[model samples]
Target: MSGQAQSPAKPPPELSTSDASGTVSAVAGTLNGLPEDPQMTPLAPPRSTPPSKIPLRPRKIQKLSSDNLKPSMTNLSASAPKPPSSKKNRADARRSSSDALAVVIPRVAARSLSCEGEVETALRHLCAVDPLLVPLIEVHPPPNFDTFHSPFLALTKSILYQQLAYKAGTSIYSRFVALCGGEHGVVPEAVLSLNPQQLRQIGISGRKASYLHDLARKYQNGILSDSSIVNMDDKSLFTMLTMVNGIGSWSVHMFMIFSLHRPDVLPINDLGVRKGVQMLYGLEELPKPSQMDHLCEKWRPYRSVASWYLWRLSEAKGGPSGVASAMAATGVSVQHHQHQLQQPLPPPTEEQQQQLVDPINSILNLGYSEFHFSS
Candidate 1:
C-alpha cells in the first residue's frame, strides 16, 4: 500500500459488490427475559421537538451485552464495589435487570462497496496476505458495508465519543438515540421534536445540539444523502461533512467506518489506531501518519477491516476500552483510538494484576487497582 499524503483530494476507489448475508448468529440475554438486538432501531422521536434541547427521560437500566467487555480478558476481574447491601443495591440490581441499553447483536445490513477500478487492485492484494483478515472480506463483503442514514448523526455520535470512554459515550448516545426515536435509530421528526434547550436537556452539550439540529435539518432537506455522497469521492465527503459543527477528520474517519463504510480509512491521528500500531509493529511512538500509511499499505481494500481487527486486538491486549467510552468530556471513545498514556507495561497477566488502562474502571465509575474475583 502506498502511503500517500493525507489529502482531502485523494479519493478511495469503490469496491465491487459481493454477497455475504451469512451472519454468525447468537442469542443475547435481555431486559425482561426477552431477547433483543441492540442494533434494532428505536421508534421515531417526536417531530417538531423544541430547538431548545429537552431533558432526557428518567432512564431505565437494562442488561448489557456480554460482548461489551470481551471474555478473552477473563484472567482480569474487579468488581464494582458491591453497593450498600441495602435496598438501594437490591433495587439497583432489579432496575438494572432491565436497563434501556441491553446487549443485542449488531444487525449489520448488506451494503455494496463501490469504488473506482484501480483501488480494487491494491485492495485485493492486501486481503491475500493475511488469513485472519480474510474474514473481513467474507463477513464485511461489499454489501455489508453500505450505511443508509444521516452522516451527521453518525459523525455527531463520533464527536460525542471523542476521548470519552465507551460507557460515557453510550450514556450520551442512549439519550441522543432516545431523542431520535426510543433507543436505537434516528428519526428526523423525532429530532425535530424540541427546541435546542430540550436537546441540551437530553445531555447533549450545547455545541453538539447545534450540530445535531443542523444535521437533522440538512438530512430533512436532503443535503446529506447517499446519492449526494456517491458521486463525490472520500475527500469530497470529508469536506462536505466537516461543514457541520463539532465534526473533524477523526469524526469523519469514524463516519467512514460506520456510515460510509469506506474501505481503507486510515485514522493515523486516532489514539487507539496509534496504540494498536505500536503493539503490532513494535514502534516506540505511534508511527507517524507517513509511517502508518506504509504499514497499513497491505491492508488496502480491507484496511478498514484490518483497522477494526487491530482495534479489537488492542482491546484484548488489556486496555479493554474497545467500542465504549469512560470519560465524558472528550466524547471520543477512549479505546476507539489508541494513545500510550504511560509507557506500555511489561506484559502482565490476571493474577499478576496489571492496571493496563482499563476503561471499565472509569466507565463503571469504579476505583480499580488490579483484577480480583471472589466466588
Candidate 2:
C-alpha cells in the first residue's frame, strides 16, 4: 500500500500567455451567457436552510364576537352617514322626479294661454309665424276674459241663449235666475223644484225645459258636478256637456271659451270664426271646417282668444266689411275651401242613453215614453 501511494502527485498545469488569452475569451463568452454581469457582482449562494428552520411571522386569526356574528340594523345605521332630511332636499327630489315625469308625460300647452303673459307670448309666436296676422293684431287689443266658477249657471245661460239674439237671451236668463231665487241659488236642487209649466212661464221651450231639468238632475245625482266640469279636459268636457238635452258642440265651445276660459277652442262650426278667418286671409269665400283647423293652426293654444277677436271682427262694420278692409291692405289672396259643416252631436253611447231617458222622461209630460234630443 505504501509503494502504490508513493507515486508523487503531479504539479498543477501552468498556463502560457496564449492559453491565458484563450481562457480569458472563454470566460468572457460565459459571462455574456449569464443573465447579468457576474464580473460586477458575486453569485448568490444556494440556500441550505430547511423551510421549518427558517423564522416566519405567526398568522393571526381573530374570532368574531357574539355581537359581530349577529348583524343588526342599528349597527349598520350607526356605521353609515345619515341621508338628508331637509325640505330643500325633498323639494329638489320632487323637482327632479317632475322633470323625469315631464319627459314621459304629454303636455297640454294649448290650455296654458289663460294668463296675460301666455297670451302675449302666443301672440308674439303667431306674429312671428304669420306676418299677415300683424294687422289684425294691431286692429284690436287682446281681449280680456275670465272663467265663471259656476259652470252650471254658465251652461244654463248657454242653453237659454241658444239660437237667440244676445239681448233677448240675456233677458230670459235674468228671469230664469230670478225664478231660481238668485244667481247663487240657481243650483241643481232649485232647478229640479221648478215644474215644466214654471219653466215654460219663464219663456223656456218645452224641450229646453226638459234640458234644464235633466241638467239639474245630473248635477243633483253627481253625474256632472261643477267641480268635475271645471276639472275636465276639453275633449272630455265637450263629450260630457254635449250629452245634456240642449248643449251642443257650438254651445260647448262657447262655454269652454267664455265660462271655462279654455284657451284652445277653435269653434270651427262657428259662422263668426269662419267669417273671421275669411276676413283675416282675404279669401274669396269662407274656409271649410276641415280647412279651419289647418288654417288656424297658428292660433292654437289661443284660439279662444282669437275667436273672441273674430266675433268682434264679425260684429264690426256690420259683419266682415271690417275684415275686408284689413284684407285689402295685405293684397294676398288665399284659396277658398268649401265643405259641409259636421253635426256636433255624436251617436249616444249606452251610458249617455241611460242618462238621457231618466232625467228627460221625468220632466217632459208628453204622451210618448221617450224623446230624442236634437240640436
- Candidate with the greatest lDDT versus the true structure: 2
Output candidate 1 Cα RMSD: 48.7
lDDT string for model 1 (54-85, tens) is 56886778877878767554444354354548
Q: Which candidate is the best by TM-score?
A: 2
Cα TM-score per model? 0.46, 0.55
Global lDDT scores for all candidate models: 0.53, 0.62
Model 2, 1-375: lDDT tens digits are 755658778998998665565566667767889443334443344467766654487778888989777888898899986665998988888898899998998533754444557777767766777787776677666544422236777677656755453345557878998998887788888888989899889888898888889898888887888768767788988888888988777667766765555778888876657877898788998788889999888766677767756755554523422222212112212111001111222333344323221122111111111122121
- Candidate 1: where is the Cα deviation over 4 Å? 1-127, 130-153, 159-164, 180-193, 220-222, 324-375
